[model samples]
Target: MSTERRAPLDRKRVADTALKLLNEVGLEGLTLRAIAKELDVKAPALYWHFKDKQALLDEMATEMYRRMVASAALDPADSWQERMLKANRGLRAALLSYRDGARVYSGSRFTGTDHAREMESNLRLFTASGFTLAQTVRANSTAYSYTIGFVIEEQGVKPLPGERREGYDVQERARLLAEFPLAAAAGAEIFEDYDRHFEEGLALIVAGVESWTRLG
Candidate 1:
């Protein structure tokens, strides 16, 4: 840690420090005072850049989203469906990068140039693919919601001891099957192969858009 203080504290610097501290303290423990201590400044100093803690949180969310948008690639050669799959996967990966990242990202307002540009380009791709403007909006919204919601659930599940990727323990699964064979069998589908689950879910959304557009 540098004893020399960074000059001219800014919103980005403050938010960046908050994100770093978030990994250590988690969201509930994060506070303006905590952020100030990380920057080696007094708590009141941050109020110069952010009106309140919520304002700082909003900036933190926006900065995360900006990075998400920046990482997505829109290749013209790829089919619109393929591009969309990449976009959704990329979004999920971004949200999962930090501790409680999805929560921070979903908490903020995405009212900035990066978000606007990404939205415009995605709309153009959908429209160019023969979907009506309304259909495009619905498709995009559904895909975005699904990705974020899935990540929220994904992040919420804690890994159990001796378990890989948050599933029932072998003994627990056997016990569940013996007591509630039918119900457990049905629920098993929801608890396995998360990567495949996400891909198949995204495919259904894309397929629904294609099918609905053709019907119109």
Candidate 2:
């Protein structure tokens, strides 16, 4: 935490600190003031880089994904379905790393160079698998949405800062059990199986994409 002649508040550093703050605080608890304090800079300093809280949040979401761009890999030879599914798993893990990180990240469209790599990789995979440019882009979007949606669901288990879990609506179970007998009997035991659920969802998405390859 040296305040020495540091590089000026670039989006990278600002967003980095914001991400750290997010892990420390949470979605609603996150504030520009908190981010400012983390970077040891005044709130006004951040204004030069981000227009407002939403801009700051969006930028942080993109900045945080700098990890996914690094950690995930794409083999050009791999089938499109395989590559896209790999991305989905990588993304879910990355978003789950920070608190409400998914909420901030999901709606953001800022594709910094790193994010672009992810996009290009998915598109390339899809195109290689015999899909058209339009199909490739659509597949990429579908994979992205599914990954983000998975993260949102994962984040639900660990209550965020300043949130009380007392209000979790278990009553919905009765309606769900009316149809899903296994769900009713399992009760909250399902919460213990995030890994299994993740794999199941990933397989479902991949299977759908695989169908495209088979019939395309």
Q: How accurate is candidate 2 locally (lDDT)?
A: 0.74
Per-prediction tally of clashes: 0, 0
Q: Residue 81 CA error for candidate 1 (Å)?
A: 0.6
Once fitted onto the true fold, the runs of candidate 1 whose alpha carbons sit more than 4 angstroms away are 1-7, 158-177, 186-188
TM-score of each candidate structure, all chains considered together:
0.84, 0.81
Candidate 1, position 208, lDDT: 89
Best by TM-score: 1
Task: Residues 33-71, candidate 2: write the lDDT tens digits.
Answer: 888888888899889988888898878877777767777
Q: How many backbone clashes does candidate 1 have?
A: 0
Provide the global lDDT of candidate 1 against the true structure.
0.78
lDDT (tens digit, per residue) of candidate 1 on 1-216: 759755678888898899889877777889999999999899999999988878888898888877776766567777778877998898887777777777777757753566776778878888888877898888888898898888777666522212344454444675768877776665545665567888989999989878877888
Q: Candidate 1, TM-score vs. the true structure?
A: 0.84
